[model samples]
Target chain A: MNEYKRISPSKRFLINIVLVIIFIVVGTLLTGGDSLSRASRALILQIGIYVILAVSLNIATGYLGQLPLGHAGFMAVGAYSAALFWKATLNMPTPVSIVLGLIIAGLIAAVFGIIIGIPALRLKGDYLAIITLGFGEIIRIAIINLSGITGGTPGLLNVPKYSSFLVVFLCVAATIAAIHFIMHSRHGRAILSIRENEIAADSCGVNLTYYKVLAFAMSAFFAGIAGALYAGFQGSLFPKSFDFMASINILVMVVLGGMGSMLGSVIAATVLTALPLVLQALAAYRMVIYSILLIIVMIFKPSGLLGRYDFSLPGLIEKWMNRKNKPGKEVANE
Target chain B: MVFLQQLINGLQLGSIYALIALGYSMVYGIILLLNFAHGDIIMVGGYIVLLIIAAGISPAVAIAACIIGCIVLACVIEKVAYTPLRSAPRISLLITAIGVSFFLENVAQLLWGADPRVFPATRIIPATSYQIGRLTISLTTIVTLVVAIAAMVVLMLLVQKSKMGKAMRAVSEDMGAAQLMGINLNRIITFTFAVGACLAAIGAILYCCKYPQVKPTTGYILGIKAFVAAVLGGIGSIPGAVLGGIAIGLAEVAVNALGYSTWTDAVVFVILIIVLLVKPTGFMGASMNEKV
Candidate 1:
């Protein structure tokens, strides 16, 4: 671990950049070709979207240590906003429209995050959960009732399918990087401190409300981006798609991935997103499996699968080098 | 006359909500944990009623079986899922409760299929109506109101006058202190869950008679709404639950009457948000002090 820390900041940055580039290149090569089936491509894209969703939720639930049950509400807001923006800018260049739509989606969701967070965050624990849930349901209801723009329950159609592999890959990488940077910064530490003990954090001069709202809005922002990607992938929007169950599904990913571990979130999201598809033969038992897994995991391993353990290439290499040096000594695993 | 009829309708619905809300209130009072599976317990009770009725059992026996089944399921869930997590963080307990709820719903779907079964309400509660001065009241409505009220009254007496009730109140007030005073914490907790389950089962029967259908997911919305009612009425307060339930029932009816039936769900949440904002403790909730 000491040897792992000896790697300077510049070297760490270089390593991260290389890893991301390798990931992007490999993803593009795998999905860019016509060799893979359409279903597989779609599945890969979906994994990317869910990865973003889980990580974004981790910002508030994992890092901030607050449970907001209305993540799907923010996603719904983003999905509809991006869908509307893209629908209106049909004549613009596709790339420009998609980029603008994503921004608008995220910003709109962030604005809502601020609006809801101010009141909702004042309460703690289960009250916060229920209040967020109420807000989420309200957002869906609003979308349904405002049929002139939202297209009501039947759904808004003709959304441009822009969530190709490259786009989704970049978005996923960007979300992870942004969250990673934010969590390492002073503000991120403040958020973590608050999660550990709110009163102590407050006494230490950390602004509780500001940081809480900030983490919440940032989480909402990324959730919005993921929602936009989802809208483009599906080419339609329905209020039903972003209901309480949808929120729970995203939450299940965050929980199943150890809370506060980005790598865990990514892996859990990937596995969960694919689990249903892989178990298509037992579709009826899929949710049953998920619920059972949730219960058993909570009971047996409440900290989750990884339990705050994150993966780092440099750390792995450091361990490998140490093992080589000590021959018989086993390097401890986290 | 229309207003009077709607008032009666509101009362019937409100009584059902009140019963469910009572369950939520009592459990929350005892453990400070929201039993998310409380509603699903009602769903299980609905299934039990359906099964028993199908087996050529008398309505009385079927109802008894449903109540007993709910009580047993609630106790089993407490022992299996929640007991181990007694020392875990509140969030973990909440998550486990959600897990238990989802498990119940999905398992029910796996066992009974997702399709809703028609509840034989007429066989259970006689289908009849009475009219007086242009006002009509269904026999089901009157029976639901009377039975719900009777149950509440019985529950009130039990809690206020019984030795077990005193122990329950003491435990809820301070668990460690009550245990030191020789109260059996485990027994009281299980007994609280059983009581809540009993109320939920009665609510389920009343709900099926009114709606005439039973589905796995039926409890989800009802549970949430009842939870909202519990919160609105000030959690841990019995009268508050009753008041909150009635208010919600009336608000829902009023929204539907205004010809915006689709918005009724949204309106209930709106009320919750507004109540939470204006009075975070709720209309009846005592302000809780955070311990260092």
Candidate 2:
């Protein structure tokens, strides 16, 4: 236990390996078995998807200090690319097909990310926000009209559902760990500096252009991973799935979770994703309540519940034990 | 003849873009807030107009009611969403505005369901068509173009000739100094929002008349395009919004004519990115120097 300071950066690899093992083991247990184990597995995969989305988006929106409303566009790119690749590799081994899909989606999304990131990075505030939004709409509209390649109004379906909870969880956990490593490293700090004060970062010899592109590419890369997994999980996704509205929903989840805190993003993702199922009785007013809650939360804790705070077991123990049986969402609901 | 028709159509729709961009430019000029809710407010206007039409109200009355409703909604948004975040940083307020935009759209869907409903079909302008020199124009197009131009001219006068206009210009130039000069910040913002919303109401009515179908989410995309136009024209500059909107409108038409309607957003952004890359101040905008 006298290893806190003695553990050099090279030894940090061990800590990462341990974290990966924990991520995989917990996911397998949650998704194990057959029959009634269905609901938990679905829930686990959904959480995995949210984690990937929040972490990747945390780069552009939270880390880089840019607000991009059209991330779902990249998700669409990955989803369609992976779905096509998966269909082509139907006869290949499951692992081969999954790897191929991930590669295809990630590569395509990264290319598009650079194209978008380069030009839009010139401006800040509302300018970046609207430009990204326009890009999203452009991609969606192109997909819709290019029915020949993209299947038009009817998106590709019957994708190989190879996205087991373990697979999804590993990708997400890897994304978070990778992002965390980057954030703590020299490059990551440079990105954070850009977020905090671009001028200062520029003055401090940080190549703003390179770091900005690096951040956006990283964000797109993980977003593509999430999209690839989504294609395999959903079995089918319409072009409408990647519309502006869905992008906003993901943005809301990330924002509500508290930006920059991977822990906040995880909790917000879990709570928001599960709330609907928990309050099925009040389903009719789901959005109204959600909106009201958002307003109230913004008015009070504008930074969110765990604003830039991590989700440690001790924090959960303190809140859960002190509070009543929670407002909604439990195993019974599932 | 085909080119002429498309050009006219572009002008008509571009005016709508111009109408909406006024709000973006004004708010950015004055408070430096992008007011992302500007688009959702347009959606609100469309929905209110739809309800009024559903009640069998006359088109004229509905348009009047719609304008009033939009004004109220805009003012409410300014007070609830923007005013409280006044002391916060620009980005915080922008995030709040985005949150509000999402809230309004989701709330609209929750209340009315997700279905895109049909607005009451009534021609606000006569559906007459006239042909001259191998060019054909409909009453709706003609009226929309004329009315849009008229509105712009009036806005120009308001900004250039009036005392309030001077205050607004002063504020846009420097809020801190404007406050020292004893101008009412809150009133000017409310008025700016009201003016923008009222303009959107007119555009909404005409949009319904032309398209004849209204959806709960109609305003979101249109709002973004208008904001793009504002940026292109050089935000905070009034003439810039008008010119930018017209350029966007013409570009959309030209793109469609060139067999690239699918790439309309992409094309619009390409042009915008090009402009920003070349001159970030926009067509009519001068670089703003913030006294940090």
Candidate 3:
């Protein structure tokens, strides 16, 4: 039928590669060539970090069907740890130290994730959300009290601004790809099954505890990565940034994007991140608008804009190939 | 002597917390929805009380108006934001509650600028203190303690004795069955919201009396902590909510006395975590098998 539906998988992959190359080229031109304002570049970087957080949250909330309200807590753990690592590794080269900082941040966040996930995942539904919220507050308070390490409420300053547009863009791409890979795997199906029916999944021999904890840990890992990126980009770390409202903002993204959809997360994250900047003229009404939008969206489309729909390049290609393989059947229907 | 004083203060604060926690527990029990907007209703009541007092009304009249305003506001919120989503996913309802909370907070900020306002000084309750040896008990604290206990007793009696309360209990036990038994589900739900808001109004006045200031964001923290109290006491249990509130109040006062005032919020959360871990159903909550 459609001309576009006749494309082969290999050709579709080539087209995607070309499109990505074009996107990178355009980004480089905008950020590096001084055509874009510094504020706009910063906004783009922030969007990149938000995309990572939203996608990670989607994994836990969308795929795993557990609403962990303490995502910001994980991000805080990652950010502070990464910044602390960078501070400690001052003697190392900047790039090497930054890379190491991200890894350590992610690992630390994962550890916290596991710690919280074990106790938290044992809970069902709303109880889990509240407990995670408590855990988030606990993390934030702990950060404030550990003044020696996190620099207390005054915040840790002088973090190197290592998160350039390119770095952030690359990180966002990698995070999305990694998450996509995970969700496309057999384990992902197990996680999704748990979301559909926990009892049914368990009866079918799906390891509920193992999968739930693993999904949570994975969500925390990427959240930490996003936090590390944010710390580097901002060159400052504040306990206030990773508070409950921060978690809510990230949750809003995941919910707005359609829980289990990666592309939806990216689009929602980008739009929401950029919306405030674009609406700077209405600065005071920003949060009012955000809250109102959240309410309206929940009322109008509880399943979100994308619902369970996802944009998969491979799936599209497969459909295209199948269509090509059945030309006569389509003709008969026409 | 100081320990005794702190204990008294804790009781006063705990009484207010218990009132708020009861509101939370009641709504949660009936609807199976955590009414996040319930706290914002207290903020609204405080503002209303402040406005009425600024107009030179009697304190009693101001409190009555505040209670009526809260009751109407809670009923309107349920009818508008919550009613449409009655059959939707529970998470959506929770999100809507959060939305309503945010909307009310922002509206408050817009209406009364975000600055903290001094609650108008009321001469209805004299600012006198009774000194006994090394302890001084303030009039407001005593009033709060008395009002809180009396209110709880009245509420218990109402639930245990009244037809309306019977309807509420039946609805909470099973909405489908209650409807089948010809109960007016909407009226019961609305009545529950009104009663919860009335208690919250009382809590708001007591809170303002002790703190003497009100801000748009004031209710957010108090609401969450009271929610912690509700969960601690066993969410659906009335006595449990009060017990949890007192325990939380005492714990906070003890931490404050220990000079770790900064860790007060963290301590509450820690208690919540411990409770959730040790007793998922809370102190008085019955085990409910989640029906798929």
Candidate 4:
């Protein structure tokens, strides 16, 4: 029997460590060496931020099976909170301030997420979407109106640039790992069960409110970290940057990437973030083309590019070894 | 006198919102989809009016072209983008609608640039005012209210008293049953979109006359607000849309009058959150029980 065997935990850990090392090496090469243009490096960093955003959103839209249109709202909360923190603690060591800023950003965004999620998740489907959207708008308006602190329409300027390639790499890795572990645990299965059938899940004795809010808060938490990275990257923050369109852009990435697939989110985020930059000559047509593509993708493949399939190097290696050992007894596991 | 003037202003604005919200309500009632592109269709109508007027066409012809343009666009979007995904997950359809929305907004931006165009009010509606008692109402506001009310009344009559409307109701009630009953699902859906688009075009024209500007991104916020109205009114209910619209418009005006003009948008959203939290089904919406 040539069935694909699961990789051992220790081997999987080794594979992950190797992959992370490779990522760090590449990141260092891009940031340290002047081989690529500054713009290209910045683009890569932006892709990393979007990867965090997309994967975090997947927790809600994919695993939880609820569409919250105001992801950027949470991102905005994280960004503004982190920016304010960094701005205030500029006198501290850069690394210390940056770490604290990210934590504060994540925690504050999680708080807002709980606050929004509790009331918002009481409804389902489109009603939930509209409510979250309203909350998003409210947050943005609050930021604008509280200009004394948020800098109003002029935006918060001159933030410390602490989002180097290393920082972003570490954050992206942590986010993916955290999400991967949570999604693999019993809690993840419960979240998935809700997505599949909320009523069935509730009948199975899953605490619907607790898990829904939990997934939402976790999603908001990572989005907050990404926002903190973004604030540090841009060295400024604006309420307008976290508007509805920005949320939609991130959603598009998650949707295009197969929902519930971290690998898909990473790849889609990378490609989409770089596409506009690469096609600078067709900049005017970029969004139009992107939208058309989105429509086409939805129409043809509603499950998205990956359809919940995740990539695993160890799994691939195991399958290859199995194929070599048994030529005629091949069996598909998935 | 100030309160009276503000009331008139609120009514005018609310009527425009009600008109737009009707389009949202009608389309959403028939299809469980949000049609996020609905607002962009109104933006397209605004561009059509601007272009036709710029081409030196008569104002009446320009307005006609605008309405037709919007109807055609909405119908085409339904056919091209949404028809195939009728059986897909609701989220997919919603995302596709967002795609269409971005597509329209980007196309408008590409064709017309990102700058706002000054809609010539005098060229269409006469720039006259009526001094009634202590309230001075502009002719534009009167025309907007009259046209909005007239369109809404006709829409209500059509939906309530017509055979096609019955077909639409049947389809919305149960698509599979409606098909079994020999209703042409595609035709009814397309017709609903057309009717909704026509109203949106009318609302767009009135909105332009009232605001005196048109831009690509204008529809995004306007659409969200109208969607809020639709939600606040009971999404599938027609009269609920109007009541929700008027409530939002009045609340906005009241905030502005309270010298918190900058917080108008915030106030509108606050009302929406409160309404949704307190009444998820909205004011006039019938609660839909989920079947296992």
Candidate 5:
């Protein structure tokens, strides 16, 4: 016990940082850079984008405990903004324009997130779901009707392909880090308190509106960045791709992996993104399978695979050390 | 004359919406589930009619089978998918409902290709038009309006005067109390799903008759709009669903008349949002505080 206390908080954080770096290096080495087939590379890149989407959605649906069914709308907004920015700034250096597009996409989507979140989040659970769903449909319809700007149903073309594996990897890492930081912070605790009990959270002086909107905006921001990456990767944009089905697909990832668990989102997103590609012959049956999985998961484990459990290497290490030193104390706490 | 024609058109569409909305309202009132699968039951009904007609069965027989098929499907869904999740979190139930909805849509797609099937209409419903003063309305529209109104009356009577209806009301009011009072909660819930499914089948037939094309996803959009109508009219109130349906139908027609057909869906959602914001309980729905 005495030695465990002597280790210090900063020392533990450094050890965690070192462990993370080692894991990343090992992961990169195992992935095999250029030896990976083109299809595999594409899949990896797609997984990164989906990781960002699933994690960001977890922030809203899992942590905040509010279901917003229109996540695709924000993504659509981000994609169009980024694609249009690239199109307009063709004269600029590719790297400079790409970064600018991402920032612009995220900021624009954040603005929309705040605008929609304010009124929509005021309503309770299912109402928020439908209203957000309505907003998603409206966004798609607007994209179709405003043909001149959105290029109509034919879809916008000639978006630059700046979404390389390195860029996507970096973005995914940044997204995970940012979300992890926010979720572990005091603000995250406040948001989580709201999820556990809104009335109690309110009585305790948590600013419901402010935190709700903030979480929503942050989720939208990352989704927007993911959308921008998608636009750059696909080199085109279609409103049809970002409909209600797409939203449900992301929701499935969050639910299947385990709500309120970031690692669960990452694992689910990666597995689901790869599942379709692996079973290309049975592509038609993919959605049916997804639906079945969703129902089964809900029926059997509604809390999800991870439930409320979050993986923490440091926490695990600390517990192990405590057990070695004084097992009775840890047992008593449990 | 054009205005009168649009009115007839709006009424035709509204009545169909009302028929579907009634199903939504009934189920929601009793079980508090949005019944996302309710709309897909309409799709199943259409496919049954399509297949039966293609196989040389009489239209009347096919219609009967369609109604029965919908009821069976709704019952099966409730028993298999929803029963176990009754005590789960509301969000979980909603997600499961969505899963059921997607499952139905995909199953339809796999069974009958994603392409819209050209519903053989001439043999199903007569295509004749009737002249009224300076305006002309099709026979199908008149038939649809009459059938919808008749069904509404029958349903209203059934709910107000019947024993099963009273049981439903009691269960909805207080499930525990109703059970203690000897009402079979499961049976009442099943009965509600059946009634809702039956109404959806009728609406499906009417909708197929008017639109004449059936796709795997045909029910998806209509289902959403009907749900909106149910909410608009007061989800648990029978008459309110009809009112909301007609209002939405007219609004859709008006938007089309104003030469912005593409905006109809968006406009409907905007209206839904506005209504929800102003009166979250909907037009005829009881106040939120009454549940306690």
Candidate 6:
């Protein structure tokens, strides 16, 4: 069992800690030792928000093996809910306001998740996708029509940007840690079983409907929390900001990282969030390049960049040289 | 009088929606892929029509030219975006189609900018309408309905009775089995997109007649509404798509009449969620038993 298992839990946990340390150090240097500069702070906040979005989506498209194009709709719910809450409770501190915002947004989205999942979960493949797409569009348009509260097309602005890096980072960490916990739990096993074979899983007594809805519910909940965090960070909100494009962005992030791989998602979100800024030379062509790359990735690496593997510095380096220098490969003719 | 006006508007709008939704339903009926970029291809067709008009051509000439142009572009998209991933999972194809949609929309924005432009509206659209008792109907309404219903019937006949229709149906049902029976799968897929795009071109012309304005982002919302219409009718059922479009059209009119235009998008979604809950297979969607 030890030989077959290949990697130990303690070592894996240690590897995560090491990576976290590395990321923190790099983030500090990139921010020039201060996280308050408008651009630097904004980048950090974006990473945190994307981490939230990408990881939550990993549950539906990644772990549950469902394609949901309506994640941004739920995010819009959270954004508006958080904005309303913050406005109503203007006297609260930043942290409490953010927490209340998270709870409110999460509850609202989870309710919606159940509504969307019930009918949609029954359909397989692209039918489910279309329903989700419809759901997303409806959310965007609804925001536009209800101009009285949502401010319609003009959007809500000057939201009082009170979010700091510490708040954002901590929220991101909790979000990631929660996802890790869920993945390692029994619920994760049920999700994977359903993804592998729904009929077979059902035959074995797995409640297919329950699990599918549960996945969507959890996804919506976290996405809501992320939206609340986003509202605080952006200090302004608009329905257009949480449009279909936003949902597609999250989907791309989830797909670009290996689906069903949590570590891959975190890494993908960070790199992609930083990518446009990092490669500023072709900013105008970002969508074009991104779209092309997305197609290329789907064609060549449908399993995504990591192919269901996690990043481990030591394990990777050890395996890296050993892999290439095999004296006599156990290669077989294809 | 207002009710009569709204009914006329609804029928005209509904017919255009029905036109595009038919293509969406037909393609989906055969292959479950949504081809999300189908609407953008319509947008592209409008641009093509506009270009031809600008090149010293009449509307009739431009319409014919643009129909051919739309077919070519749609076929090329299928070849470039979908052909390579045919054997991959269904979800991958859906995402690729989405990427294609983004590519086209961005390309339009790059070229046309974001400003809304009016299509050339002819004086033929009557300024007023004739009343029949309490109900009034306009020529535009009559023409659009006549054109849409006629097109749908012909398409139904072709799909159900024609020899090529048999080949298309055979391919849609099961590609491997169809290929084993000596059918060309690529030709069928290309033909499907071409036909779908051509219908979309007709829909574009009708939409331009009613709204008279087209912009890069015009397809975004209409695309969603038409998709809802497709799903509402029973995704793979052609008749279902037409019915769904009419229902959504009526519902949109009702929402406006009720003084709740603000809730139009919301109401449509609520309808979808409710429908999905009541009948997950959609109004006409069928359940195919998966081979374990």
Compared with the true structure, what per-residue lDDT tens digits does model 6 show for residues B1-292? 8876787777778878888988787677666678788888778777777767767787788788778888888888888878899889887888888888888887888787768876665532444667788776766677778888888888877777887777877877787899999988788878878778888888887777677677877777787778888878777677778888988898898898899887887787777767766776566666432100
Task: Kindly report the docking quality category of candidate 1.
Answer: medium
Name model 3 segments beyond 4 Å from true.
A1-18, A314-334, B121-124, B287-292
Q: For residues B148-222, what per-residue lDDT tens digits would candidate 4 score against the true structure?
A: 889988987887779998888888788899999999999999999999899999999999988888899989989
Q: List the residue pairs that clash in candidate 6.
A: B233-B240, B234-B284
DockQ of 5: 0.84
Clash pairs detected, candidate 2? A147-A152
Candidate 4 to truth, TM: 0.96
Cα misplacement distance, residue B79 of candidate 3 (Å): 1.2
**Model 1 misplaced regions, further than 4 Å:** A1-5, A321-334, B287-292
What value does the lDDT take at residue B225 in candidate 6? Answer: 79
Best by lDDT: 1
DockQ of 4: 0.76
lDDT of 1: 0.90
What DockQ does each listed candidate score? 0.74, 0.51, 0.66, 0.76, 0.84, 0.61
- Classified by CAPRI criteria, candidate 2 counts as medium
Candidate 4 residue spans exceeding 4 A from truth? A1-6, A330-334, B287-292
Weakest 10 consecutive residues, lDDT, candidate 3 chain B?
A: B283-292
User: Candidate 6: misplaced stretches above 4 Å?
Assistant: A1-37, A145-151, A313-334, B1-4, B123-136, B284-292
Q: In candidate 6, what are the lDDT values of residues A1-334, reduced to their tens digit?
A: 1111235667767776777767666665665565457776788789889988999999999888889999999989888888888888888886778777778988998888888888887687776887787788788888887788888898877675656666667677777877777877988889889988888999999999999999999999889888887888888888878888899899888888888888888888999899999899977777777788788888888888886786556577557646644545534311
Query: Which regions of candidate 5 fall more than 4 Å away from where they truly are?
Result: A1-9, A12-33, A319-323, A326-334, B287-292
**Per-candidate fnat, comma-separated:** 0.69, 0.43, 0.49, 0.80, 0.83, 0.66
Q: Give per-residue CA lDDT, model 3, range A66-144, as digits (tens).
A: 7888999999999998888888889999889988999999989999999989988768877888888888999999999
